[model samples]
Target: MRSDYLGFSCLLSAVILQATAVLAADDDVLKRGAYLMNGPVACGNCHTPVGPNGPDLSKELAGGTPFDFPEFMAFSANITPDPETGIGSWSDDQIARAIREGIRPDGTVIGPPMPIEFYRHLSDDDLKAIVAYLRHLAVVKNEVPRSTFNIPLPPNYGPPIVSQGSPSPDDKIAYGGYLVAISHCLECHTPRGSDGHLDMKRAGAGGNSFPGPWGVSVSRNITPDLEDGIGSWSDDEIKAAITTGVRKDGTHLMPPMAFGYYANITGGDLDAIVAYLRTLPPQKTTN
Candidate 1:
């Protein structure tokens, strides 16, 4: 009788320890995911609905905002883990594939403004962490409109499934370059021709025009050109512009360039971004 009781107690202790370990691991993943989504990744900036001033924090990640471009109008989807309106029904693999390959569960291509091209470089662990975090979101019911393309999509419009490894955040230039790619800086900054194709030769020269209620705001040249680009700005100045929306000259940047989303970026990430920007070839542009 004594031996049986001891055995039962040991088994109970083992089970409790196992459960505790699992919970700890899950908590770690959630923390990492939260940092990525809220900070560098800035998922909330697009996914969350916007109020008159900025993002509607109450409806965070509930989605209904429309991103209008010349090619298409893409509405951000609710990602709040609601079965009826969010990704609650999606399998983990489905979400990972959509983020890394731009293919939806229904086999349709996830069109532009999604930034799947850059996200494809996310590490496996990071991808899993993001999914785990998404799975635990508070259920919010919000149905978003389907994206519509004004022009016909090309045969191979979506990005191919690639297996590029993510750069270490410690490597300033490489990490900065990675951040720039995932952030889709070129999509907004680089000028596109009449046919809506980016002119790669003049990349980062920045003359892309986005007309809105604010007025016709052109993306500034971010290249290393002394006169027309941010070449002459100090590192602190660059960081301020990115995080505060205030330029070195004390002018406020127009909308579509949301600095608020970037306010929480760590000093290391900001340093990497500045390091990468310094490496760009000098290109002059009149904006």
Candidate 2:
């Protein structure tokens, strides 16, 4: 009887230890995730609607940004922990998959407005941290309508690539690919070719344009073009533009640049992006 009792006690103690470990891990993850989600990456830029001046802290992560441009109309969905309104019903795995792979719980692929490209670079641990933080958010009762694009070619407008998850950490190119993704460089720089695939030949040649409130704004080619891109600009110039929203010409990059919020990206991460961008072939753009 004593032997059996000892086994039972050991099992109970093991369970307690495991639970404690899980909780500790979750707490650490939540803290880090909050910083990343709210800062650098600034998921809140779109997810949390802006106020007269900036984001209304009251609506924190309760998403409802109407992103209507000449080509697309979409709204950021609520991502709080609200069981009915937010992601409260989603499993941690489901949430992690969506963040890393851009697939919804139902296996539907999300597009455009959500900026999954940048998210595809998140490490598993970072994604887990994000999931933990998401679990603890206030569940605001906002119900955003599920997005439906009315584009005549909604299906074929962008390339039909599917994000599976982050790549092997040991692979430098893969890591660079992840950084480029989370930066969403392709979303603005890579124009679609005749077959709807990103013209790899012009990967960072820029020329992508969208109608702005006052006029059309173009994303500068990120390729290493000595004449048109950071190729000629020193590292500091690129970094300044990224962190401060100022450009090489001392003019401010317009909205959708979102550096107003994305200015929080960490120095190390920004350096990594610069390093990766330098590895790309140079391509000049007039815009």
Candidate 3:
């Protein structure tokens, strides 16, 4: 009788330990997801609605924001865990597909401003982490308007949904390239056509114009063109520009650059970004 009681107690302890370990792992993943979304990824900049000052902290990721472009109006979607409007009902695979393939659960393509092309390069672990973080958001009940495009979307518009492995953290250039993609650098820097679509042929040339209270600010050419881009700027100059909002010439950058948020990026990540920028081919911007 004594032996049986001891055996039962041991089994119970083992089971509790297993459950506790699982919970710990989940917590770790959630923390990582939050860091990625709020830090380098900066998903809230677009998805969250802003007030007269800045992002309404109360509504966080509830998503009633409108991105007005020359061609059409794209409204950001509410990504909270609300079942009726948010992604609460979406399965993990469904969310992964939308992020990686730009395809919705119903087989329809998610239109521009979503930057699915860059997100497609997310590693499996990072994708899972993002989903985990999103799932844990406070279930805000906000319904966003659907996006409408004036021009016909090109056939096979987004990248192919292939399972490409992400670059290791040690590979500075490759990892930086991945970070740039997910951050949607080209979406802001690359010039858009009259129809408001990115001109891929002129990528990195940087003629895109963004109008704000500060004034009409244009993205600078980030390519390796000595006369037109950052080829002449040292790596330190580039890092300072990104993190401090001060350019090599001592001019301060305006809104939409998100330098304040980027200031939180680690030194290794900044180095990686500089390393990646050095590899871009020279492309002179007409602007």
Candidate 4:
């Protein structure tokens, strides 16, 4: 019996080593994919809701935060890897389809809050890496409620061809940030006039109005300005906010940031976005 136990232990160790090596081989892909999920995607800021203040840290990827809209209505769902509650039962391809096509694992269409249109251009490899990383996260097993929606969250809002000034190649971090910009992060984060169109000149300068599940909130200025934009923050600070949904002063990032899907990001890639953001012209304005 002792000999048999020894054999089992040896077998387990070997399997662990092999898995570690495999993960090492795919490290770069995971890193890049992680960047795509966090910085540009900002998935966790909104999707993976936070637990009670300093209560439990185990429910990392399990999403359940309510996402409200202008009216009192809203929706939220779990994105964890739990078999019964999260995305665990679904295959990588199914998850990818949802990211790229807005189709859910059950063949139903994921509603507007998802912004599936933005991910239509992701390279297949990037998508796969995202799947791998997500599949490997700590399973929270929390049963999140179904995501409710009012079809188009924003009324009559049609984003333009290039959401951010334009798309640049190879610089995935920049591309991701651009994706965030174009994805309408600012539309809700930045304040708008009565006419309804966003005041582009003040972009990311904050003051945007929010009406959703978390409550009536205003968007913060993300520009490079020291006072308002993220200029005063360290790269790590920005990353914490983007990844864990924690804010600059140790406060949590508010609703709509969708930090859950974004938290799987590789640490390195999130840094690159900080580098890129530092280069943008700092803007100081009161939206």
In order, the Cα lDDT scores of the candidates are: 0.82, 0.73, 0.82, 0.64
Q: Pick the TM-score winner.
A: 3
lDDT of 4 at 1: 100
- Where does candidate 3 clash, by residue pair? none
Better of 2 and 3 by lDDT: 3
lDDT by residue (tens digit), candidate 2, 1-287 = 99999999999999999999988977788888877676555677678877777777788788878877654687888889888888889999888777766777886776666666557667776677778878888878899886767554332223333444566545656565666676566667777676644677777887767664537777788778877767878778888887787988899887666676557766666666677788888875744
lDDT of 4 by residue, 41-96 (tens): 55555565666562134665566666565423444456678888888899887887
Clash statistics: count for each candidate: 0, 5, 0, 21
The local distance difference test score of model 2 is 0.73
Total backbone collisions, model 4: 21
Instruction: Please tell me which model should have the higher lDDT, number 2 or number 4.
Output: 2
Once superposed on the true structure, which residue ranges of model 2 sit more than 4 Å away at CA?
1-22, 117-121, 151-177, 195-197, 212-215
